[model samples]
Target: MLDAAVFQGLSWNLLDDFRQLFTYPFMVNALEAGTIVAVMAGVTGWFMVLRRQAFAGHTLSVIAFPGAAAAGWAGVPLALGYFGFCGAGALVLAAIAGTRRSLGAESAAIGSLQALALALGFVFVSLSHSILTGLDSLLFGTFLGITRSQVLVLLVVAVATVAVTAFAARPLFFASVDSDVARASGVPVRLLGLGFLLVLGLSVAETSQITGALLVFALLVTPAATAHRLTPRPWLGLTLAVALALAVTWAGLALAYFSIYPVGFYVTSLSFGVYVLVRIVTR
Candidate 1:
């Protein structure tokens, strides 16, 4: 998969691209919004990769879709509805399993919720007056339509997510790497797990707005997975993950603007490609 010719042609210079980026208001908005989402996803996704909670992240995204659709049908803000629903689902999972269940059981619950959410989203779409295009957009995403207000909202979420993650980093890491040891050492493993789930829920809900629920996994998994493969150092892994996420989001946005496909498609494809490359190299 390593293409020497393509690698050779890729330019790192930003000056030429800088003007192109600022020439359009949509591009600016996309960049700002994408960067904010990337930072949050990157930080939380690092723990997600380490803890093997990728399935939970995916389930949260799937559940958010129906919530967004229902919100749209009711003429409310989609983000709030999406977060509320996914957060509730996260809470339910935490309560039922006590955040200490085996991976097999967790996976089973996530799978069930994923299916249920998609079914509900489809049913809502069928009953609503809105066309399939709107629902489809929420599923696959369309960054070109993002407004400046949305960008501002993204910034706020990003800041809050990053701040919380920073403060919770030590205990979160301890619990994720070894919950038994953490709990033995007097760490509130259950509480930590629930808090992380809440953060994951919010991140997935916000990202679903930009990349859609189906494609949110790309942002939530790829960069962190790649970073984990490249290094075992926690801080280094997080740094690499954030950098990779930012690069993919910015590059993907540029490619989408220049291509015919939607931004989510390009972003997901790019992220998957990077993960594949990292896997190959690490192997």
Candidate 2:
């Protein structure tokens, strides 16, 4: 009879597969992009979770999906369309729903935009008369086929994201943790809020390419949530979040290379599992 764990596709022979992970250039690229995406998502997501903007982040991802699908239909890079549409959506949200009191309205607007984008994606798919494999993969990423060009783009975006987040860290944190005090202290809380949203839009765009727009929320939320449970200090939480994200991405990649499932599936599951473990351990 087959070994029970082997039947489930888990193996101690993953070390052999680890060597194979770097044998192919494409796999190398995937690992690079995935690492960047994980770090950015983890860092930014920490603030998002703390500020209770998970719903907004989810909305951004959903809205980006149709743009990506449309790009595929038009025979262009999915990143271009996803970033444009999501950036627009974010700006619109900020303009129409600028204050804490208007959060409900912002959510409603995001929902409407998500529906509209999905409908457009379907229309584009029908018009193109093409296979939906790419679109489906974008919705639920398959890490095995990542290309060199995409990897380069991911690196550029990751670097830019790090820079923007670093520059905005002080005021962003001040506003996020205590907006009233920040504003009273002469912080431009309104601009800071909009700035954070814009950065979040970029993060969502970059991650959606790797994890699919739908699953991006997993990476963005899980690491940050887990880190928050372990630390109350903002800087420590951010650092821990980044570390946890790196661990999840690396672990997931290793598991996927040795297993039968997609990398996105393994990564997301591992992240959630880590969060649960952290919570239990802390408790």
Candidate 3:
């Protein structure tokens, strides 16, 4: 967990700035990891936004905090905790929703889960009894020290997520817009809901690695939301969402490569800027 986001600054020339993006192995790894995360998050988040589950997405992001903190405390791999706890959280939310509760009730359950997750994260940090040096990275993220192995892991998970999401896209879309109609049509609405929740959890966990737990929405929601505002067509919106995600990610890397700021900040800022611009233009 390296806190340093960049090893050098730009040379103030076009070619030099581009060259700086790959001047180091760490930077190259960071770009690779970011690209995988952006694509995965973009596709999954498009569905998440459509389902109006931003709260659930946010809760899962919070859920990743305890997972990562506890893993660091216990000296295990952080990715294990990230995916495990987020998956558990998603299942819990799905179960609560499965009860056929009202939207208000489901929201209450999700809020409670978020609170518990935060408390658990604090407990893990306190119980560690030492400075959690990677604390900043856990919350704010940094792209300075990612390894090739980590990049490979991201690539595998991203590919799986995109593949499954694409395979189920039609029914998932139908279910998301009108579950009652989709169910009436024998689309297995309940099962699709469960599967999508798991996919959301997986995307959050992966995006959390780059944007950090607190900032997962930077990649997961903003790009998708922006695309939704721009297009009514599903496939086009999804493609645009992924394209925006890549833009923010690559631009952030380039900017962070020439500055002392963390890549997360640049990413979040760029994403927000784009989203705001879209809102204004669409208004």
Who wins the TM-score comparison? 3
| TM-scores for the candidates | 0.90, 0.90, 0.96
Name every residue pair that clashes in candidate 2: none
lDDT of 2: 0.80
Ranking by lDDT: 3, 1, 2
RMSD of 3: 1.8
Ten-residue stretch with the least lDDT total in model 1: 1-10
Error of 3 at 141 (Å): 0.9
Better of 2 and 3 by TM-score: 3
Q: Which stretches of candidate 3 lie over 4 Å from their true place?
A: 1-6, 130-133
Q: Give the per-residue lDDT digits (tens) of candidate 1, residues 71-97.
A: 887777777778888889778767756
> Once superposed on the true structure, which residue ranges of model 2 sit more than 4 Å away at CA?
1-14, 99-101, 131-133
Model 1 residue 183 distance off true place after TM-score fit, in angstroms: 1.5
Mind giving the per-residue lDDT tens digits that candidate 3 earns over 156-223?
A: 98899899999999999999999889999999998998999999998988888888899898999999
- Compared with the true structure, model 3 gives a TM-score of 0.96
Clash pairs detected, candidate 1: none
Candidate 1: where are CA atoms >4 Å away?
Answer: 1-18, 99-102, 131-133
